[model samples]
Target chain A: MVKLAAKCILAGDPAVGKTALAQIFRSDGAHFQKNYTLTTGVDLVVKTVPVPDTGDSVELFIFDSAGKELFSEMLDKLWESPNVLCLVYDVTNEQSFSNCSKWLEKARAQVPGTSLPGVLVGNKTDLASRRAVDPAQAQAWALGQGLECFETSVKEMENYEAPFRCLATQFLHLYREKVELFQGLV
Target chain B: KMKTDLCLSSEGTEVILATSSDEKHPPENIIDGNAETFWTTTGMFPQEFVICFHKHVKIEKLIIQSYLVRTLRVEKSTSKEPVGFQQWIEKDLVHTEGQLQNEEITAHDGHATYLRVIIQSAFDHFASVHSISAEGTVVLNSS
Candidate 1:
């Protein structure tokens, strides 16, 4: 089986659980940060995700970055040529959700003219009492922007792996298509 | 173990795509085994070029000769297509002014039918790749 390495970029608004979700997934929900500190340049993590039935795996080199232009010029260097994207936002904050478009635009600018396989993550779902971004509304917008939508609460330790698994599966699907296209050319 | 120069044009390796294509300096210069002739980037820091080996090869090592490039990333695809390329290696090159930056990298047994070389960032506005030579073995699979 082929083990491919892909550069996965994690981007979102500040305090939207980008770091928490990433740490949880990397440690298989075992390690969660108690105190939140501002992410400076970039946090690089490597995880191997197996494609379910295909027997292949994608080694994701995740570049979890800061939110909303925090030392953004330095971020541009780390954000180059992302193979997969995870755009996160807080469910309790409508303003953070609204800024998804801007985050997406910035990520896409790194690799111009390329369709980046991405997922829109609505984080902090446990904050239902303060939920501002509607699930259905976020789903519709994600669909319109060619992104798969998934809502999860890192604090609640629920469904954190779904978005990453979806990205791994999607990357494998793209690989299969390329193999077919090359075989067709032969 | 035998080592083969997998990036040679004589070995059926062809450069399929390049972000910068100058009339005088072409992308094919990288595989021609001549350091004097080179492929120069036109406008940006993240310029790239694709080299198709036409078959699956497990690249053991790669030697790249370039100028002014600071950060370089290499990706590959087993499908031999322009699509589905995945990251293989990335390096932060040290710039020594007035000379070519010769980088030799170990591939960690990277297998690919096509390889993409990306100049992610550079010390200057433009960078030139003098040559790229890879040592590897070809695998034959019929599936």
Candidate 2:
């Protein structure tokens, strides 16, 4: 049994459903709510998901962090252990989307050890009618960050599984291929 | 009536609370030149933190710990506009023994776009802000 630990960062505004999304992906019977108690410190939750083809179970340690400036000191600690990053933003708020660059910069500075793969999540997509962020703009921002972006609605569960599953799959695939290549050389 | 007061942090930018015991490392104190901050409820001690969200919000209860805040004020801005601000007066020392105390103040007419907390003048310790958690609720509504 291959044991792999995956770390994901849920970076977004206070009530943009970052914690809700993490809970949905990581735990069973996770409920979605309108109001969430703002995360003051770094919140850590772990979940195990099975890879389809390989049948290997990957344990994901998801960190839902506070977006306030007071918690900046803890970024290095969170970055040190994370294998993947999820840069979340609110679809209804353009400023949240605009701040994505700042959040990305912080994440990059923390994880200098590896080219940490990131997923741009436009959360609360169910409120797209009131969306201030256009898909094209969000996509362009993702391109500029050299990361893949997807819009998700935790309320409606739209494209919910795609973002988490895609990131997990990519990490597993790359790890397996690299190990095999190194073994063949040895 | 032995009542306990629990100070909690609200979600918004501007205005923070600090206890007398937490002076060395307050909430919004960033390191070096890197300005980064996070909001937290659980720490060494409990103090009430209030932030003025530029947008209107519905708050149910105002809970404070280890502190007796007599007046709660909500101002439009830092400018000295006396008309728009509101305050409440009370005489409750909510703490008996040196333990974590919790107080619940539910609002029947307490809805605000901005919030500020003023502890009774005798508490000895003041509040501190960690960092502003502005989620752009201001810009979107104004625009």
Candidate 3:
């Protein structure tokens, strides 16, 4: 079984619950803080996910970065050499959803001429009554951008692991492909 | 009595300890006096490093160039060996993106042979210290 490690970055606008989503996935519903403290820099968390049937595991070093524009320059440094990306937005905030493209552009710009695997996540699904971004629309945009899409709610603990698990699976697939290519060349 | 770069390894300064060390970005970069080179933290919070000068010096000001640094605490020791550190300065730094944080702090009473810098916290998962310049004159009488 192959054990791989990769850097995963989470980016979004401020107040969009980026930190909450990360905390929920890391703690597995054991911890949740009600008080909100603006993340001025990047918070690092690590988690391991097992690939089904293959017995291989991937350890993800997740970098949860601040969403404030004032910290945009510092954010770029944190995005260095990311293996996967998690572009998140608040479902109830259309502006956050609309800003997804901008965030994606910035992340992609960091690694020019390379295609990085990523997911487009619409968070705050618990606020469905006040939702402004339709899942279908978000999914369509995500597909257009070549990213898998998922809706999650940190507050409700709904499908919080889907995005991370998907990333791990995709990374493992890439790792296998690289190993095969090297073997074939030999 | 001209000002000298007291932290330079070429000038008899030594990086005694750094909690997190990456081969590409070694702790010596902090005193290299070059902004292009840097030492990056590998993991976790409260990463720290110790710098020992060849002799006791009276530091007047310190300029640190770094990125993603949130809270920084500095201490000094006058003993022959690296021990008995006393708090000199502690302050929170502002975060700026796409640019290095050039922080200039006035260190009024930094008379010591060893200086310790403790990064209490950072704005991000990892932080980088590009360079640290200590402007002061060496104390001739204080061996």
Candidate 4:
């Protein structure tokens, strides 16, 4: 079985729960951040997600970055050559949801020539009463921008793995396509 | 259209993990592109060293310069990290009297990020691997 590692950038607005989502995913929902900790720079976490039915796995080097611009220069050192992206937003904050475009643009600009596989995630859906970003709207925008979309509440630990699984699936597809070229040699 | 040396230390490839290490003979010698410097196994059989490329590469062939290596095995991992290895190639070397045993193996495999070369058994108690080189092209992608 081929286990491929890809760089996954977790980016969104501050307080959008990108860190919580990543922590929950890594810890298997065993722990949640009780207090909001200001992420000053990039926190790297590696996890392997098994590709369903393929016996292959993608090791995600998830670089969870701070949303604040004060660390842009420092973040760039870790953000270079990202393989996949997870742009997160709070369903209760429209501004956070809209900023997904800018976050994605910044990620793509790091490596300009090639296509980056990514996903748009609408986080904090447990606050359904304060929902400001429509799921259908987010999904439509994601489709137009060639990104898959999903909604999850990391606070409630619901549907947190879908976005990462989606990214892994896309990367696995790219690996298979590239491997096909080498198959012709032998 | 052009093939490059994928195992050169000057080309961003490094020996991340190795089973044995000697002060005079380190695993880095395997990719240093110099056949004079070599990594010698201190003891026992089944010694291995892992080579990590800058990125996933489609190798055309792998060449190893060693002495007294009887059975050698090669494993490949596509993961960005050194994990999830699947067996790729295993070869029995042609032992030499006092000369270096040079074995060249071809590639009929997919893209690889790390290659683990295991020296399962040797003709002598200690074996030395001078260098290893892979002729391939890098798979260019954003990730």
Candidate 5:
């Protein structure tokens, strides 16, 4: 049995669906709107997913971090965990999308020397008319950062599984590449 | 062994505020073998209650059993206005399971005369005192 560990960082502006995105991905169809009261410190959750090839499961620990200024100090500690990072933004709110770069920069600075794999998520895609962020702009930003970009709707449960699974797939690919390179080294 | 004569008159439990200026409403500790004690009828001030230590001690935690009282505030002895003291005090919401145990702490400067428990706010239900326990190591502060 493969015992793989995964941790994903949900980062973006406050009230940008970072928490909603994580919950929807973790528990499919479990839609809820708890009080938007700002997350005081860090809220963490974990889910286990199965790997088809080995019939084994990997634990995915998700950190729904606070996006407020008070959490700046904690940002550094958040990056030390070895896992994929989901830089989430609100599709309906352009300001959240614009602030993605700052979140990524702060996360990268936390783990200065490690190669981090991450994805950009434009959330709340169900609200097309209210969208303040343009898809093209988000895609350009993702391409520039060498990361995959995805637009998701947690409320509608649309494309929720794809983005998280995409991160898992990328992790496997990265692991395989490292193994191959190490084999050649021997 | 001691012999004593006892008399009983069916008087209902009397309840009054702990802050009554009248000596008749003075708070008294319920003793194990004594006349049945009555509950305080009057409500605690928005921020006022008296504290009496059984013995000299440094209080570490104080648990408050209240009912329908939603908010709490405590004030230092010198300050007239009540300041929020809920954050500094560590507590568990006793009211979570349909029971009431909302807690708060009064300012405990080295020199504290009256440790007051204030009722900042309340809900539809009247607040009732179930129990209040103070835990701390005994120290020689007062004779």
Candidate 6:
């Protein structure tokens, strides 16, 4: 089985459940902290996910960066040559969803001359009663941006693994494409 | 005593070893004293490089310019050879994002012939050290 490694960046506005989603995925829902300490810098976490029906696996190095506007410029350094992007947004906050485009632009700006594979995550799905962004609208935007969309809720452990699994699968596809191109050259 | 750039590559100071070396960003860039030129890491965490001074010197302070660096550990050795290292300073730096991490650390220590820097962790996969300048006076004592 082939093993691959990909650098995945989780980015969105502050308090949009970016950290919570990442923590839930990293700890496998074993730990969830109530108190929220603002992420001042980038937090690194690694997780390996097996592609469905495939013996291969992809180890994702997730770079969870702070969503504060003050730290936006810092994203340039932290987002260097990212293999995959997880653009997160709060379901209840309209502004957070609106800012997804800005975050995507920033992430794309880091790697010029190449298209980056990414996913748009509308987090806090458990807050459906207070949701401000309609799922159809978010999904439409994600599709326009050429990204697969997923909804997750760390509090409910709802679809928390879908986004990561999608990234791992896509990275494996990218790796295989590269190998094929090199083989054709030879 | 006049202060000089102790780690200047042009002055004949050498980088004895670097754990990871990229062809575009060589370890010599760390001592080049040019902020534009930088040395970048190619591998995992805990990357390091050793710099040998022309002679034993008292280090008063150090200024490091880098990008994506998180925790840095500095060690010094006074042996005739590049062995026997003692921890001199350890710092957890604040991330500045798009800008370079310009860190000025006070390193008051006795004469030492070698210095090693360990990059414990970075905010990203790769970290870059643009320049490292040591402001200090050379030791003239024969003993």
Q: Which model scores highest in DockQ?
A: 1
Candidate No. with top TM-score: 1
Q: For model 5, how does the per-residue alpha-carbon lDDT over B93-133 read when each residue is reduced to its tens digit?
A: 33333444436444253222224455553432123344444
| TM-scores, chain B, all models | 0.94, 0.46, 0.96, 0.96, 0.49, 0.95
Over 4 Å off, model 5:
A29-41, A51-57, A66-69, B1-143
Q: For model 4, how does the per-residue alpha-carbon lDDT over B57-102 read when each residue is reduced to its tens digit?
A: 8999998888878899999999877999999999999877657788
Tens-digit lDDT track for model 1 on B36-125? 777776433478999988888889999998886889999998884678988999999997666778899998958888899999976643
lDDT of 6 by residue, A43-117 (tens): 677777889988877777888774544565676677776878998999999999999999899888765655678
lDDT of 4: 0.80
Q: What is the lDDT of candidate 1?
A: 0.80
Following a full C-alpha superposition, what root-mean-square deviation does model 1 have from the true structure?
Answer: 13.7
Off by over 4 Å in 6: A29-41, A67-69, B1-143
Number of clashes in every candidate structure? 0, 24, 7, 4, 8, 1
Better of 1 and 2 by lDDT: 1
Q: What is the lDDT of residue B13 in candidate 3?
A: 89
lDDT of 2 by residue, A114-165 (tens): 4667789999978858999999989997988778889999888677666777
Model 5 clash pairs? B15-B39, B15-B40, B15-B41, B16-B40, B16-B41, B16-B42, B17-B42, B47-B118
Model 1 Cα interface RMS deviation (Å): 15.6
lDDT of 3 by residue, A12-109 (tens): 88888888888887777423222223365457777777777877766777887645444767887778867788999999999999999998998888
Give the per-residue Cα lDDT of candidate 6 at A172. 70
Candidate 4's residue-wise lDDT over A1-186, tens digit each? Answer: 555667788888889998788888888832321222335545666778888988777778787765544477877876766778898989999999899999899988875755788999998899999999999999899999999989998988899999999988898787565333222221
Q: Itemize residue pairs with steric clashes in candidate 4.
A: A3-B79, A4-B79, A5-B79, A5-B80
Task: Please state the error at residue B119 of candidate 4 in Å.
Answer: 23
> Higher-lDDT candidate among 1 and 5?
1
Backbone clash tally (model 1):
0
> If you score just chain A, what TM-score does every candidate get?
0.90, 0.81, 0.89, 0.89, 0.82, 0.89
- Per-candidate local distance difference test: 0.80, 0.53, 0.80, 0.80, 0.53, 0.79
